[model samples]
Target: AAALISGHEDAYDGFICDEQSVPAAPGEFGVALDASLAVWQQKGYRGIWLKMPAAKAHVIGHAVDRGFEFHHAEKEYVMLTRWLPSSENKLPPNASHQVGMGAFVMNERREVLVVQERSGPLRGQGVWKMPTGLVQQGEDISEAAEREVLEETGIRARFDAVLAMRQAHGFAFGKSDMFFVVALKMEAGPQARELCMQEDELVGVRWMGLEEYLAVPFTAARPLFQKIHAAILAYVNGTY
Candidate 1:
């Protein structure tokens, strides 16, 4: 009974092969699996996942011959899966991972904080954006936001809320980066007029009103710029 496999209604789509049901002997294991798959087909289950422990690695060859393919692996186990006859599965391509954090900060005057890079990808392009940087290992995202803002603008600020999250693959060197934008309220640490840009990275740092921020040709075209705009409105309305 596919319906009885789990309480959830979608159980008919797949079944999980139990580790306990794996026979120690190679011959018996194959025999048992052939019969199990036949029954699954008649019961309308579309696929089955087999989880094998590191200790039972010898069974990998037999599992592969029976149509199972590698799905994912962990430190202690490898998971193999197969689709039943007449079923099709669409799997995504493998990808790389990277993550970054940004800060959308505004002072009491409603002017947004922005930075111009001195080096790296957009050097000397005259494009202004919120202070953003890659998240460091063992650093919390919120902490990364605060650190990036102060490091670039020399203006201390406290994180208020997550304004938005945007991501894309193949951003650079065939890697994917997830960028999170956080809203922040300016604190009384550094004055904008005395801005201190980070050496070798930032060339300019200052505050600008929404109209001026969007007026920057490069800044207005960014997808996240619109999200920051809406967030600023919500923040000013006391509803963010």
Candidate 2:
């Protein structure tokens, strides 16, 4: 720490203290605060940054009470500044939600556009899998899924109906993520792959019949996908 400070004079435009130390308890935070203030004073530092992980809104409010303000970095985390008077970083007025969106893009003959992920933590890469995405801003899950199928597989789709919603919990990228299971009815023409590929995110996209999808094995979430398909079949048959 000494070497970093002395070796590079005026090197940092300003500093971001990702963390000063592990978070202290309710009363102990005052000690950390005093210690941090001392360091800032002695070092001739002009600004301080703090990171509040998770929904520590009470702690954040306390920090604001101590004159810290927060800025949103992304959907997942916030960056806080302690050099200025606090202001509200209230989450915007739009209602936010998370949902699973998926599709069974079947043609008149019942073929579907299936995509296989090429890389990353999930298995079944480069194999047959349904097109899917998470519902985003202004997106209804049903409509979001249709857009996902079209974006991932280049197949214009129409929904049959929602099939199911269930909790899918598993490890990927070294952490557990839960997803909602959703299914929809869809139809596409023979030219399903006529559009450009979202190549960085997908390796291959193709149309396959239910028998073919069932024939080829999937890795994680395979059972979930299979169940969605079965439900879609039932829905299309007027039984579900």
Give per-model CA RMSD.
7.7, 12.3
List the candidates' TM-scores in order.
Answer: 0.56, 0.53
- Give the poorly placed runs of model 2, Cα more than 4 Å off: 1-97, 168-196, 219-226
How high is the CA lDDT of each candidate model? 0.75, 0.59
Please write out the lDDT profile of model 1 over residues 18-60, one tens digit for every residue.
6766665677767777777777778777667777888878877
Error of 1 at 5 (Å): 42
- Over 4 Å off in model 1, which ranges? 1-95, 189-194
Question: Candidate 1 at 179: error in angstroms?
Answer: 0.8
Clashes of each: 0, 2
Which tens-of-lDDT digit does each residue in 1-240 have in candidate 2? Answer: 211111122344334554435253445555565566566656665556666666543456656667766654556556676552134333232223345665666655667667767666555545676777777757677678778877776766665566777654444423333344445544445574364567877877777776776566653347776676677668667788
